[model samples]
Target: MVRVTSMAMASLLSHITSLSLPLKPHLFLFSHSPKPTRTLSFSTPAISQNPDRNVPSSFNEDIGPYLSCSMPHNNRRLKVAVLLSGGVDSSVALRLLHAAGHSCTAFYLKIWFQEGFENFWSECPWEEDLNYAKAVCNQVDVPLEVVHLTDEYWENVVSYIIEQYRCGRTPNPDILCNTRIKFGVFIDAISSMEFDFVASGHYAKVVHPSGDQIHKDSALELSQDTVKDQTYFLSHLSQDQLKRLIFPLGCLSKDKVRKLAMEFDLPNKERKDSQGICFLGKIRFSDFIGRHIGEKEGVILEAETGDFLGKHRGFWFYTIGQRQGLRLPGGPWYVVEKDVKNNVVFVSRNYFSVDKRRRLFHVASLKWLQGLPPNQMSQLQCKVRHGPGFCNCTIIIEHGEDGNEDVAVVHLSEDDQGLAAGQFVAFYQGRTCLGSGVILESWDDQGFSVCAKALENARMEDKSLLGKPVKIKVKPETVATESCQLDGMVLSNQRPCKLST
Candidate 1:
């Protein structure tokens, strides 16, 4: 059996003390037999330094309860392939598994753009990421392998994203990246390696069946860190993928993970969390879209009045409910709809008006982890996007043209403004993830057809008023206060107004 010597423990304690960390004594205990059995127990409770954060009491629980099938047991040393992303979370994850007496092999996936796309690849920090991943693996004496999945990523994930955007739908690339690249192709690439499991720093728990429940399928659960839970992205994974996966940071919060990184003195301890799309690195989404889709001039029209507001690069550059980059005057404008055939974008100042109720939508291409939908379809919680928020929803099964139960009509208890086609809505029952489906359509309950008719009528009226004298009756005292010039067009703050044609 191998053990952490007293001197080693004293040195670790001294390091923690020098950092002024409020950690209690005897935080970790390991028991390694001929077949290496280990346990990680934390006596000190995890407390959030930020009181504004709403963390559950379970955050204080030790890591042992969440290990599930990831840890070695009954004198068995498991071989794990850990995915290191050169971030603090994965670095700490590698350290934990190595310390648990597992034979760990670290893999850094190289999926960045190719050489010809240097304009898009220039900002990618993949080289820096690989360096950090190598340093972390070297620190733990683990063999590191670089797996190049660029072709697979582009063919599967990148193409899907581009096609979805071109069709004027908002697709969640992260979700597709997980299902198609990370766990899908990456699993196939390592199939002959005989690794027992594939692990990542994903903040979600996997409950593999054991004991009397060995016949049941493995379940994915929400991590202790609600705000950082990544089940939304992994909800599209299949049962086979779920069974072969392990998440070491599932029970630990971001705060606790940072503390562990400090304790371990990892190479990427000070690295900030990566944001935006996984493959894009520091490149702007607009720039990438422009590079591929190549913008065309389009007109922006007001949904209610059909007034020519301004010009846009293209209709594909915007999504439903997008409020940024519109740059319209007279008020804050939001993207309400898009006319793809006409290359026209519709905007409105009162996007959240009382008439707009985005509570109903249709979801297709369903992927349930247990190979079946939940028995209680009438009640479920769903997330329209990846965040610490869930909406009380009910699912009504619908049959497709082939008479298969392939569509689900979801009705949210409250209205959501960000609902869009091609976005994956992750369903949940308490802590267990029930799986997810792609949104087929977001029902526009705001009388969009009526708005379109109004736009047509406004266009006809404008044609009639052309080349005719227009009279304006404005209160003399309020003219200076209420009227403003925007892009050589006069706009009034009062009602019943007309602009020069």
Candidate 2:
């Protein structure tokens, strides 16, 4: 674990200025003056704590019930390979596909797990997981092929995870791993194996079976189980990848999946789900990385005044807006910032925002799924996290001052707190997903800095959609706040709307 101190206070504070937006009044309940000199102390929990040590491994069982029973395209039989993990969901999907009369095969990706991770893999060892996948093949009577992807997994996923942490960016390894390793490497292998499509247990739906490049035309819709939808972690997948992918569990709920698993009487039907990191199950993420990334104790302080609150194990382990493991004197404290180079964790109660008129926000390596016009991108909803709601935003796209051709800036309509540099900012339109980008820079003022890489990929340009009619369902607040005069009004891109103020 990393820690912070007074010397490094300026670095974090320099990035955070005050914004024009009025914050909660109780924000100033603590120190009013900025005191970067004061220091705080905190105690952190061991990083390797495992919550599911004695749980039985759900691997080594039949996996037919967790999948959808949809027949593959008849002519070709749609030779498909399902990424089986010996988990209930994947098993169910496997069973469903086999019952649908599709030529299905199971591919279990065996990656390297951290040392001593065996405690978590009890009952269902790695071999058991693989055998369970094989067991499913026996029941469905489909050929099961297990491929060893340790080398690719290490080089791609593990290396990338380490690199991201070394750079102070909290990388979502699962997303990147899926894109680069699972879908990239594994899919590539399956392609050569002559599999028509690759299937998984992801709960996301892809619309339009044909005639769409960006998939915006073949929009990716959220699954029925909004809570169980894993699309957020999957937005990084390419349109081509999505085309050959199958999500048999997209339409089913968790409860429904369990019921089906029971009906199929699969070996792991009653098996519990795997939790924690993907490959390094049950091991605390911080602990797993702590071994590789050396840790040093640092100061934890109150964001208001540099008042010493507690000590932290490592800054790299914790993220902004985290509320646990603070061990502070007050009831509870939230992490507002992490100083990686100097080592510090900034803590704050519910309210402690600077009222200055300037702030900064940044997005790095931004990729756009659709080529929406600048006007549309600016006018759409922008969400920074996985919360249900969103914020109305106005994007001011601009070139970087330093003349970095790949850099751009997007000014939000409001100043948001707990903005981190490495997180993602996804753009959406109603229930439809437009695209997303990375957080390049974050500030209290100056809006957010975004990179240009992903924006290009996210562009959606189809002339046919230009004149298509779109329904506009305004929120009650939008209608109540302004008087509607239909003489000249623009609804859902339709123009000629005049409103009386």
Candidate 3:
């Protein structure tokens, strides 16, 4: 609905035109949207309220000293390419890099989106964002490059998003997209551009020990910004990837980044942080998903009796633990289960009622981000979603349906209601992110995925698609009548025919 004028769009285009090697236009199918310049209000938290003050920001902190102590001394400038999204965190990173005299180049990535979807997903325009990044680069005197990843984004990122939702998993496209695109595609681009390293404004850190033996092959060390830290999402990145990565904003808390952005006079000093899909702007999850996937209205049910309660807008619109928007007439109710096949969402009068205890869900497609062997993963702590505190649960890794390996179920020693199918179940050891895997299924069954207490302290395996196919039997007579090969596998009484040789 919101449109940017041609003049404004052209102004943003000038930077693109200025590149020595012209960018391929198809890479950027993104159109500009209209947004207002914001007057920001920054409220400093009370000293007691700041749980992340321990995170180091300056060159004097523990992280800085650790890095300084580790590597061979070099006076040469660190050539770092930052994935600038034109936000406060990134702006601060640029300022920090520039101040440190690092040979910093800002690469502004442009991924295409549906026209009106921008307003629905985010408030800022992609063109305006690119322009802000250019302005900062021009002011900071660092070269900025713009790369449009439209097609690759759709194929790699968007396609995965649709598939994840279709299969009933709440996939974190940002993390996957970051792993595959920003670090994957964008990093490859920088290799051609001759940059020494890549950086971003992500609120997570990577560190190495102080010694001659560079921990280039070592795991990424967790930063102190646990509240603002994004290490969980970055868990999928490998040691090889971390070898050339930098996080200038990782050491700083969100507040310090804002303060530094203000002190640096960066244009996006007060820009609000993006909340939803990586590039897609402020659109609601269900609405944005609706643009790509069909929104089929489903039945709402009572958790105990399975009685029809009411109709739901769409199952895609809700997650497992959601409680606020059920619109029920009875006393307050919570969604206890979703029957994606029956098109139903089940609710309960009391969320923690004793009856809710009997039913449990199963998890599948569990991946270890670090690709840790099955042994180390069994010992780590797991977080089912972003905001919830880490739960002390045992990890179970086993082969599952169709030759795919998955996480069967995370048995919470204590029952926590509102478990959803498509969310992440990240594993951690203390502050270090061991790795994370997509939650496949969850529920209590005999021999549920939990490792035995003696084996609970074991590690995780890194094999992909570990489940065997479910074999079904088709009517034997039909196969013979149809002249189909009788040797094919049968699952749930449905035999898949193999064509006769």
Candidate 4:
């Protein structure tokens, strides 16, 4: 309904560039790239276009099996609150639930940038999203409510994100958005309405306890679409939250959802999937951080040797395992560590060095969906980020001073370069998501803490060296590719080492 033209988009980007704080060159390049358009067309049998018409037999035959397991056991029509974004997945989800004979109310959350952040708000097409959401709800005669949770989002989610970044930790805001707002505050907001359940387009499964298993807690499982599965984001949800939530697209793949969208003839059937952190929308993350935290010039140094390499806007602008924006000659460099106190970032060519084992990490503030830790903690699958990949992990429960289970020491079967403090590690046993915990710090296999202690020592040494001016002529050194033997295999394809004097 509110179409943003290509000219308008380009103009908006130009305005961003005209701001007092210019974005990084690479970020500017990324912003200038053309956005992809979705042009899918299907010739499937026509389903009834009328909202009042009964679902076609063909529709039932196609999607019936998937819904069979998720539908109400009593076969009773229920009042459902559906979280509708203007995306195709959510639109198709609303249609599926409508066909399932449930009374549905659509809610479009107005949690975009609040006032005073008009610049960011203008960049995000939330008005278009809301318009599309309204169109989808109107198609099915479902009443749409615009919930203003901007204050709550800023207080709970946005504030936490800023604090985490300020503390030099990479936090996953999407995971918090699902846990704190979508399921947390939204549920409380509509509690007085006494809706039977809340539903969404998330690609994750929630299996409610039934029959004799009614005594057991609701289980969160992976979606049929593994690649699109969103359990990582939903991992922090409590058992109560899972019990009251419904994910219609859990059993459906992305391709199947697109087909359903065509069959339903929904207004947003051709809408492309939204990307990046939900709140930021089209705004570059660097620009967002720059606006909030601002920038301070910091020095980049080699991790093994304290040789200066280059300068960065700020240490907070980069993250571990990052290989971009370093603008240094010689070869590719990876961010290995950060000296938060000194505002310094450390890099290395041999990021995957055997000496720098990232297999072990400590996680704090555990949230178990089942109300308790899993019985089988030794053999579990864990994800450090939102993706299909899962690393086999074992948990060593650490007790607090009061003898309560306080921390979880997770040992990954393999090393993860991207492991960062404040990131959530969602654990899974088979299809069921046990829950997740925040990574406190990481360590090497030798039991040496790699993140905190190592960085602290570097920070202290740098502090002593600060304010003492010394001019030293630096010479470039050519080092051969470093190789290591792992599991009886030699890894000799490592990047050529770049040592600075």
Candidate 5:
């Protein structure tokens, strides 16, 4: 079976960064200064070295209870598929798993990136990343498989991202890519293989549904490495995906992982962490959006006095509460509203100028883990965006006119801002990531709407929700719920989903 290895500092460091600081997690306990390069050495562990390897003590003893050795692959080693992203985290992931005595194969999924836009922007690192992944596989003594998934990625994740921006909504493409591309489509391709599970370098944990309950509805939880936890991206994945997946580096800190790369002498050890979109290299978000949406010049007006702020790219390029890259003079401005029909963007110097703090919003296209979590309305923490962190909220289930569970009305227990349509809201109970939904509408005392066309056709979808209130009604009335089930387990027993005869 494969094992994980992280952190091999010759000596522990001199200082520690504050937890309050929003910086990437580091494993080296040293001063912020760079340390002298040290050569890392490790004796390769062959199958003959030790038939039953004792897990390293540094990985923590507590994991023993959660990841006990009594796995299904009792006599045989697990056939694990490791996703190599050509970064420090994934590179080290392969080493850790291979060392643990598991049979491993590495795969690099090539995705579609607008490489033609290289003249205006730098070219993406697809070729370079592939080479790095290959080198890592060689060093780890694992065979590598390269899968070309450009067409599938473009059709599902990329197209949806462009469409959302074109229609004037702030969409999280990473969430879609994780759910549809990595776990969803990728799983289909591996169906013919004899692989037992898939592994990635994501800093997240797959746990029993609830603490000490590993029955059926188990979900992914935040990693011990909170600074770089990636549970938010994997929020929409299904329980089946979680069942066949493992994050080898989930419990290790980033700095610890990096040090292991150096210790194992793995390729890409010094490779800088990937930034921005996974495949899209280093292009600015606005520049990337401008490429697809094209440039639709509009007037930027001050929300307070309707004073013209400046000429702006199409209102689609800006999201509510955006403060950077505004190019507007006389000061910093935050986007508050978008007039899609007239092609105008409203900005303000004050954050709460257009609306008061909002606590309630509506979410459509709700996809739950193992189906909707007990329909009883209750408090759960949620994150509107990947970076807004999380806030306490009470989620009420809403049903359509036909009595089928349709959407969710999330009432933020604390005041929050910048709620937008097309963005995902990831729900969480403590550290466990429950599920997510798309923002259909958000409201407050202010009369702004992110996707409602009634206010000015912000979301240019075919059906028009004219005259509909943006603020969802929270009366806590009875709402019909959808049935969620799988062949092996039933998500809920209360509502049985009708099968089409």
Candidate 6:
């Protein structure tokens, strides 16, 4: 084994940090790795090819007229606290707010990380973030505030994220950071700071209140930057958080924001956008996870026959639909199910087969943005992850005592591959994002979970259990199809609430 020093580690991190577009899309929403100067994160798409065109940065073509639908777009300069990640997006937001004559203060939130996991999960560069943040603040003559939320972040987001993964789920830390940290702890921190509203470079728009409804009740409109629109991450933000917050670069694209940073002569204009977990810096998912969960040896069995196909680093190291790192023989395989307690990974070559692909699943802890959306089952578009384009889905929810739908069963029009537990599902009607929920389980039953768990008693050292007879259980049949109401209803029901183009 080679000995690694902090100097060696720093150099490795610097090299790895420059690698943009991490393998994990959900965590790298804001890839703000530290550079010579600080950079702000707007969760923008890859830099556009053409940087010259200052595209119309509005919900629609007419921004002024659009805001006029509810409230005025312009108002007197107000003291705003901007969440600056020391990147181009947030930096530009800060400059714009400062230029517009709003009293601005840049805040950099710090989160928890493994003490010495350099090769995989990176250490948070709070010091460098602060330095570049200061550079921009000094240039604009604005004050910078760095709130160390390591304890709270670990307590609320980090622990929950790790726990979810350990329990065989792929949790999205970005969503949690928005709900529990950025909009949660940070919002409460500034409650007495006398700041009018907290702003960030997130590519999301806050639709001003409708009618006499002033601040807190305003709706969240999808940003004009559709490709980079982070309404998915911001979907869990409460109405009160929306009221006290502002997204400065809501209408601008990533490339356009970069251009503005250049035009403004911002100090950290060249700083690469951070490809990281909210504030946790860009890290290798497996390495970061293993640091907390530790690695355990497990068997990778064939999904259909329960044959001992191969071995995995750990069940926690793999996820549903993952094709890489199997290190097995012959051909590629996909993880179908994870037996967390038994430490077994179920894989199959037939990823698109009848027994594998799924179109429907159950989700617990359902939350509806703007109150409960249509109690009746309605057909709407939903995205499984942070990417453009959506699949048609019929929403099935069961209401709780408070008249809130605590449990939801999403019925997809077609089977989708790569569905993993613990991922966030966002509901959308065209450009307007409705809300999101956590995927509890899929309706899959191919002896994937049960067969894998019974391996020890079956004596699998010689791999005899590979072809053992196992009965497959289907979700609808096991959970009662009558309750899901999948029998007698039409799914072509579209909501009349189509958003403006």
Candidate closest to the true structure, highest lDDT: 4
Those runs of model 2 whose alpha carbons end farther than 4 Å from true positions after fitting are 1-76, 113-125, 211-217, 351-360, 370-375, 382-396, 399-418, 446-501
Candidate that beats the other on lDDT, 3 or 5, i.e. the better one: 5
Best by TM-score: 4
lDDT of each: 0.68, 0.54, 0.53, 0.70, 0.61, 0.61
* Tens digit per residue, CA lDDT, model 6, 1-501: 223222312222111111122234322222224223212121111222433223224312323322232222556668888888777788788877776667887777766554555543344566677667767776656666566666566756777777777777777778888877787766655565577888888888877664355543567767777767778888766666677777777777788778777777777889887764654555566667787899877677666666666566778787776666776555445667777767778776566555544677766655566666754457677766664446778887765576433667788766665667777788877566677777766464532343533455334555444554233332232111111100011111111211224
Check candidate 1 and list the clashing pairs.
none
Candidate 6 stretches with Cα past 4 Å from truth are 1-74, 114-123, 279-283, 375-377, 400-405, 442-501
C-alpha RMSD by candidate, in order: 15.5, 19.7, 17.2, 12.3, 16.4, 12.4
TM-score (C-alpha) between model 2 and the true structure: 0.67
At residue 110, give the lDDT of candidate 6. Answer: 63
Q: Candidate 5, which segments miss by more than 4 Å at Cα?
A: 1-76, 114-122, 208-215, 352-355, 403-405, 446-501
The lDDT of model 6 is 0.61
lDDT tens digits by residue: candidate 2, 291-400:
77878666665565555555677777666545657766543455665656556666655322335222335554444444432346556666555433356655555554
Ranking by lDDT: 4, 1, 6, 5, 2, 3
lDDT of 5 by residue, 51-108 (tens): 3233333443233332332123243567988888888887777767777577887877
The digit string of per-residue lDDT tens for model 4 on 330-393 reads 6556677787888888877666666766778888768899989999988888887766778888
Candidate 3 lDDT over 182-280, as tens digits, reads 886556544544566787887766664334766434455455455566776777666667777777765566777777667666778778876656655
Candidate 4 lDDT for residue 120: 63
